[model samples]
Target chain A: MTAAAADKPKKLVIIDYSGELEKTWATMILASTAGAMEMETTVFVTFWGLQTFVKDKKRITGENWMQKMMSFMQRPGASHRKLSKMNFMGMGPWMMFKLAKKYNVAKPKDLLEMAMAMGVQFLPCQMTMDMFGLKREDLIEGMGEPVGAATALQLMTEADSTLFI
Target chain B: MANLDIKLKVDASGLSCPLPILKATQGIKTVESGELVEVIATDPGSVKDFDAWAKATGNALVEQDSADGKFRFVLRRK
Candidate 1:
């Protein structure tokens, strides 16, 4: 290998906090697609995203009407939005999930399963666990230890690519 | 009949979005070049999702048909 190639990092770290199924799937696709190209991948789920990793959590619900309304309002035309604006209620999240079902998109649980099958590292956020009063046992099987955001950030810093979804 | 001779069917019904793509990805991996994969789905999002998947993965979608809340996708693996 060339000297420059030898110095390059082959790892990717993704910090997923969107909590929406579509966003989560998008993040997974990016990471897994990268991994398919031979990059090592690590996904750190924090805050609301951590709920999806919990064994008993069936779905990530909008906390309130305002949050739900704001989610819809923030799509495309919201003044304060910075990241890619998505329509969760309209053609975004629900649609993505529906198409996924029709096209045999991997189930949320199956995505996790495929991640494991593909050797993707799954890390749960410790602070989120504390905030939610959840224990390690509450998480699905095959998850790594609960880690702090700092540690996750460090991993991201060292990775070739880092994404916050 | 000759033009549509190659037929491949994938039952993505009851599955979710990325799962269909994921399954299609796996299914395509086993198919020879120029073979067609027909995916049956109920999700409305499958329309755009399959289009995007075909674009991203270098697969050619020969046909897409929808009726009665079900979608049929004919993809030619490149």
Candidate 2:
């Protein structure tokens, strides 16, 4: 590796496509850890993954009936996300939260805040926002301006490491 | 113990994964360069994590030890 390259902080880019609680938790963990490690990190959230950044934790989002139905089934927001497996009618997430607390692990909300505090960037997908009929106000505070797939791709090209979660 | 002057102490016991390292990173920066930062962590993974962190961040790990389920590390700021 070049000396200049070694001296510069490593850049990491992550693409989040799933809104499942487990995946989002993992993504947050990595992002925050990378920030702690002094890596320049960015997370691009798209499709269902964007739900994790919604402000309305329990309410269904979207304008059209179909979009509303989808939101109703899955809900929107970080706290409302379900496990991809072993959900067990919501008991699984409850149990997971208990375990995380017992282990002194930061919760999803805290992790998101910590990542932001550590300078990790969160970019929501513009195409996904329009397709889901979501406005910028619908997202959580401190989100980066909406950008398309090309922006994410450009970031990936420049990043030293890239992850699709 | 008395000879090694520690400029800062980070207590990360009961925390998980990245938190220990995260707190250490923040703590180390508060001290002047060449000063020592001491960290106590309960996470078993922190041993290797700190090793990699020291190498990656250019901090020097001066001491590492474990006792009574806690891991201790002394790092000299770069």
Candidate 3:
């Protein structure tokens, strides 16, 4: 590699499509760790992944009836996420939180904060927002501008490592 | 060992993977170049993590040892 390229910080791009609690945890942990490692990290959140960034308690939002129903069913926000398996009627996330605390692992919310503090970028998908009828105000604060597939692909091309979660 | 001057001491015991390294990264920055930053962690994975971090960041892992289930590392900032 060229000297300039070698000196450049490593870049990590993560394309996240799932909003399950475990998956979101994985995305945040990896992104935060990468940021800690001094890498340039960006997460492209699309489809269900965008739901995780939605503001808490704004569960019943959307422009139309169908969109509203989709929002109601999914219940936007990271705090309301369920595990992909062993959810056990809301018992899984509770148990997972307990285990994480005992092990001194940061909660997903805290991890997200760390990632933000460390300058990890979160890019929401514009197309998904339109399809889901989600407005910019519905998302959590400090989100990067809404982008599309082209932008995501361009970032992936420049990144040293790309992850799909 | 007693003569070594440590500029920063981070106790990361009971923390999980990446946290210890993150703490080390933060601690190393607080010290001047060539000064030592020591970290104590309980995570088994910290051994490899610190080694890789040192190599990747150009910091020197000057000392490392483990006792009573806690891993310790001393790094000199680049």
Candidate 4:
């Protein structure tokens, strides 16, 4: 590799704070695509976006009654994510998934799995977790750890290719 | 089909954008460096996507052709 090319980092950082189904799919698609392109990719999930990391598809437990009720309404995990528009109370996400399947396009969860297997960094937001009363067990397995603002700052500032979605 | 030796072949026909490229990359990695991999895709976007992916990943897009409504791309791993 050329010295200049080797020195330059081909990293893409994504701040995924959107909770909508379409938005989540877009983030996963981009993350997987970038990883395929040989770019080091990181996805920082915060606020509603943390739902992507929440394994709500599996049986979930809450710390307390309020947490349980909240988890019931706002389950964390990719499978139960909702759509931002045309949700029709939930039909939108299902339709989108069906369409993706019809076209042989990978689903959001599959793309996310592929990206994770490819070594894309997946981080939860510590402060946001504290605010939401979510614990580590509420998230998906294999996500290394929760990160703070400073880590996001460094990654965002250092990366020439960064996306806010 | 030409008599070119392909180390790997990925059929991405009927798939959409990003899937084609993603599958192509997966196939590329299975072969040794400098080996060739061919991707068969029906997505119209594969033409430009493969070209750009080749340039970005430092691979060689040795041949790209569309025949019988299928887009074929042969790439050499860098």
- Higher TM-score: candidate 2 or 4? 4
lDDT of 2 by residue, A1-64 (tens): 2233359899999998989989999898898888877789999999988999988554877899
- Candidate 1 C-alpha lDDT tens digits along A59-112: 322345654454344331111112235663455555655675666556455566
Candidate lDDT (C-alpha), each: 0.66, 0.88, 0.88, 0.84
Task: DockQ each candidate and list the results.
Answer: 0.15, 0.49, 0.42, 0.55
Clashing pairs in 3: none
> Where does model 4 exceed 4 Å of error?
A1-7, A59-62
Q: Looking at model 1 chain A, report the run of 10 residues with the lowest lDDT sum.
A: A75-84
* Interface RMSD (Cα, Å) for model 1: 8.5
Off by over 4 Å in 3: A1-6
Q: Which 10-residue window of candidate 4 chain A scores lowest in summed lDDT?
A: A1-10
In order of listing, the candidates' clash counts read 15, 0, 0, 2
On a 0 to 1 DockQ scale, where is model 4? 0.55
Best by TM-score: 4
Task: Give the distance in Å from residue A89's predicted Cα in candidate 1 to where it truly belongs.
Answer: 9.6
RMSD of each: 10.0, 2.4, 2.5, 2.1
Residue B51, candidate 3: how far off, in angstroms?
1.0
